[model samples]
Target: MSNTTNFKNLAPKGLRIIEQTDSLYHYARVISNTRFGYQPVSVAYCKDASHVQYCVKFCSQNNKAFRIRSGGHQHEGMCSGNGVIIIDLSEMNKIEYIDNQPNQAWIPVGKQLDSVYTELEKEKQIIPGGGCQSVNVGGLTQGGGWGYSIRKFGMTCDSILAAEIVLANGTIEIVSEENQPELFWALKGGGGGNFGVVTRFKFQLSALTDYVTTFGLTWKHPEDVKEVIRVWMNLHASTEVELDPALSSSCTMILANPDEKDLDCDGIRELEEGQKSFVDGRMGGQFYGTKTDLIKLLKKCFGEDLIPEDSKFTLLKEVCYASKKKSLAKSEKETHASLARHQSILANFLNPTSTPEQEIRATNECKHRNYRVLPVAPTSTCDQPHPHKVSSSFPKKYTCDDNSEMTERIYDFLSKCCYYGDVSKYMSFHCLGGAVKKNVDKRVFAFSDKPYLLQIQGWWDDISNAFDNQSRNDEYVKWVKDFRLNIAPFTEGSFINFVDQSLVDHPETHEGLLELLEIYYGENNLSRLRKIKAEQDPNELFKFKMSIPPLIE
Candidate 1:
């Protein structure tokens, strides 16, 4: 029989197999980074655990290489590769709640963050997850997911109660602390596509608050970039001000644009007409509290000079209206009555060019039942595929004197980096603390005690024409590489979720796979992870470029 006939015979009934001849095969091959020409032989769309088992068996018996794809959001495109069979779980997404289990739910690995968030909101529950809505629970949880609520609730992996996985031998196993303890520990924050294919996760959910206050503050002047970083770092550490544990924030600094008309990868111009046309810095996050309390906290931390008294009152009234709260007294409304004035002040400081109508529409869309869940701005870009590269590091807290030097280095890069066509370059710092420091020995996720995670990211449009101009791609790629090098001394370990291929493939270092693994899981955790890999996948059937290898006996 032919290869196609053999695959069809082994596949379960109703399992869709998209071959290279099929029209949808091209679409199946596209990942987050379209720059790498990954051409999979065929894509097997698995709908359930049975379908996954059959595909794994076929690949094992036929000696065919395969890669597992949940959301295809892997930074380096390791989820799909050239000439490999793709086992896609996009069709297997489903959320199930157990009887009498109010604090937990079973989430299929293929479910994206947006869908999970919407479904969990129905029960007034949440799981600490990443900002990008398209990132699926499988990869995010496996790589120690970070989010705006990270400081309060900890990572997505920390919430995992158990997981159902299919081993290379086509055996299904439920892994938890009691069952297969080593494998269970490895599954939590040991990186995706390593040992087995995780089909579903039983997550321990947290109670969602009735209301949340989301705030954004920007420093427009290039000269104030250092001060912005210093203050933001102090705020994250709670050194200058005693912050509430319910608050979590991130700071981002964007490279200045050479031309005013150059659009970013999001198709928005960084330098607006009336806005300050310089290196822009923004600090924003979600606060599980009322608008009144958030305003008080910000004013105390940032001072009245940066956050004027008038602007604070305007923000308070705007959030009250957006949330549709009726608690504001009529006399208080009359005291701060100008709605247009509130929106104008917010537009000037927080979100540029935002009107009252736009704010209301966005707020209404994010509303779940009666509760208000405000997502941080720059919402989901899942539909738009672009070429991008990211490198990350978890830096420890520095003293005031040390912070000054680090701030200067970061400011220099943001001010001097070259901008390519339609490329957006920035550095993001996600604060880490509070509950993240509670459980250090339960999982393989390292760097939980670190202060924050920093990501050096670059994205550009026109993915179809990326290869036509090699120099443009090189310039953008080199910019991120150089920035990573500049901050190498201050940073320690890298985040596995933000995997970078250059760490192993760079010409200067030529670091081995083991060295790259050390950077992600540390030396001690990596040793245990390899042993579990040996137990689960002895033949290395489920392997990728950055996957863990079986320990040699």
Candidate 2:
């Protein structure tokens, strides 16, 4: 936007505008704040697409900053501005379905996740979305939405059939695969607010089943977690993988810091400084099929026989365990045994004193209804408190050995930061095959080819004044980066949803964030995006940190 701007006499009728120093400044700022940094000059409540168009034209004519806000859950607050105009679409939170087109619907950017779910539940339909309930559809879809039904359906972007956008020239238009195909393609997993102000999105929906079966498995023992992870990476998380489409689960675990002192946390059971951090690993999700089929698929985690193969667990009936010096059969048996032993350990952790319960859990992996599949309510602030710095690694290839070598590396990396007593840090591994790989171009869409997404999350829950405790924040930031680098060998690349400042805008870039841009979106896609940015938003209107840079700039 041009710098020679003037807001005097700019207020328009039918627009609810809140200027700085207004009584509603705090509320307006919160709505637009990324929880990172924000101090917009004013926020204009847009009731519809026409208002959004007016905002674009108004800002363009005035040469002022302008960014759009729906849910305001951007990792780096890409929708925020310092002293700019914010097109708040909160009033436009509306949804409508196409007649006889149960699979297609039109939703606005301001609608929250939970609202969509609650409304869809009434119709016995569902839209694949993130876990957080308050995340707006705009940010989630643009960043490639993931949910409990991701494998069954696809990312949220894949569901988008069309979008209603207000371009930089104040021209409102519809973009779909058939019209403005390039811009439409860019909107899907191409990052939001780059092409235009997305007021409404036409999404494809999926029908929900009656009483989805939720399942889960946990591993508490350190050694068991290591082996369990290895088996996962080898089978489910593997790139050359063939998994049951009905079954999709994430293998996530966290290591607590053994050295965490009682004074450091509240409500947590106190432990000695030297005590090792407890390891907690869980995997499984709601299955769209019967219990029998789900069981068979889960059994693949261990040898088909559900027997322990480790040398420690003696196989009762094994005549010749492969003849040649530890033959293939022998190795396979040992690996199977290791997995069973790990499973047993995990089951026991869940039922410490009840041997019967532990045995049953190990025998029956699928528990009662998969824990309520829900999304965390998003915070208005930019640097979200739950996980301050979330860096994700999407690996299309991986190597896992029965010796538990691969999982050990993951454990070694995880147990360091989330260890010492911090329960906030975690490593999440998601199965990436199924529908995600089928729709859209895997090479272009983020995390399409990479079947396994690893989220290395760091929390800022020290309970101290964040503003005053800059050093503490820095500590966690450093730990997150250091740990990510250490596991870089095992990691394929980062996920765009879990943005990293260091990678997105690396300090070493000559004059721009060129390096991180290519890293986020591959070179070809990034180039195409740049050209779109040039042609569509020549004035560099819609932008923030990590957005596509226009050629004119």
Candidate 3:
């Protein structure tokens, strides 16, 4: 940490370097609230592959540990560390589509999800990616990106045709199935910052549809919450129900917040002063079809009576409808009304303080659109950084009736945790097992065989409060850890994308790096990854607390 002066001259010409003395150092250093206090020696903002190579070479020569950062959204903040150099890739944001092959594109590792989605939508194409817009393609694809369209097209890593990586030796290599196949395989879902610095990814893109339907349904009542969760899980895991591959959904069960108010078509309705605490469950996702077809599919899955009356649904194409259209059928009018309702709900869902005027403007702007535009702003939730702790796992398949004890335990944890602190807490069940499990043998991403991905999350808004109040922050972190432990019996393997540092710290759950690797990559895949790590980065220059180390010779 003391040799800070050497970094200034080590940075290549045209590369921007922010040392501790620089005014922008603080801003460049902290990416996530969890890593707010991590003070890096310097942050090198690499613009392209050459700059990345220079930074890698600098770190190698100085024998200084450096962390690779793209979107900087790593849950545990391993993308950064205290008193080390950070090779920041945010400046290398660019996308180049292949001329004749419209279905393929080379995206820089620094490109965030929002820009990627917006750029691809212009070409009527998209890659399967997570919902968080600020997440960079580097870490996301490396950890096996999951999104609403995953059930249709598979993971983001699955679409990776090739990658341009700077190895530990400062040598650049473009890896793919046809070249450096083992390294390429390891790149897919092997976890980021494990192997080397990935400069860009050559992705095999999928055609983007114009009229996909997105829906949201909330069940506030306790009995209704349990019933919705039961039905949703059954829809994904039940062999008796022939669920469509075109539909991908997730359910979130949130512990009731005393400060939260209910907002409906009427407006905000305050909760009763001393209302008993309960869990609120919401199930919703996108369908690659029209509203009419989506309604039919939902009815088939939930039955007519089970479908909530106030459920919100809308078509992506509805945003492109011309306001001056001559005549509308009764069904079309209902669909428009539904779109309006959806906008209202979405605005409030993202920001409760959103004014009625903002809601109307959001809906009205959508009416005159000509091209396909994303209905909801993908960056709404992730625009600002907050202190959060998350742990994820692939849950084993279980029917509603067969897992009564597990269900009760999950509910019990959710209900009891609300009284501990004011942090926002929820468990999200992301449906899997459609295209996710199709070609598992060809990729390193493990746990596709599991029915769904369960993420236990806790978020705190005030960074100052989080750092100052140790006990308060501990309550939030402990809640996530305790909840994850409660459901350990029902889950198989951990998701590398939602990496947790505590897994390595805890002795009971994992003995050491080997056990942690097994939890993240499975036994067989872990061995393969270790061998590849040895071959590509034998020196272990790219290493962290949870990073995969080279196999001992």
lDDT for model 3 comes to 0.72
Tens digits of per-residue lDDT for model 2, 1-553: 2232334245456778887868998667663222355688888888888778778887887677887887766666566678878888877887988998877889888887767876664455678776556578887887777766788888888888889999988899999889988888888888778889888889777765533444556555554566667676667555465776666666677654343232211344333243334446666554665445555566665554332233322111111122232223544444532321222232222211101111111112212222122222221112233325667776535655522554666666554332322215567777667888786672247557665677776543322122324554576678777877877766655667666767544534535587777777777888888888899988677767677886554
Best by lDDT: 3
Superposed on all Cα atoms, model 2 deviates from the true structure by an RMSD in Å of 13.4
lDDT of each: 0.71, 0.62, 0.72
Query: Total clashing residue pairs per candidate?
Result: 0, 25, 0
lDDT of 1 at 439: 76
Give the better candidate number (2 or 3) by TM-score: 3
* Winning candidate number (TM-score): 3
lDDT of 3 by residue, 1-553 (tens): 4455777775678999998889988778877655346888889899999999988888888888899999888887787888899999998888987899878999998998778876665445678887666678999999888877789999889999999999888889899999999988888999888889998999999875545666776666656667767777777776776579888878777766433456654455333333333567777676777767777888778877657433343222223233343334556555543432333343224221111111111112122222122121112336556677888887664867644555566777776543323245778778887898887976777787777778887765433223434664686788888998888888767888877767666524325778877888988999899899898888889988788877866
TM-score ranking of the models: 3, 1, 2
lDDT pick, better of 1 and 2? 1
Lowest summed lDDT window (length 10), candidate 2: 354-363
Query: How many times do residue backbones clash in model 3?
Result: 0
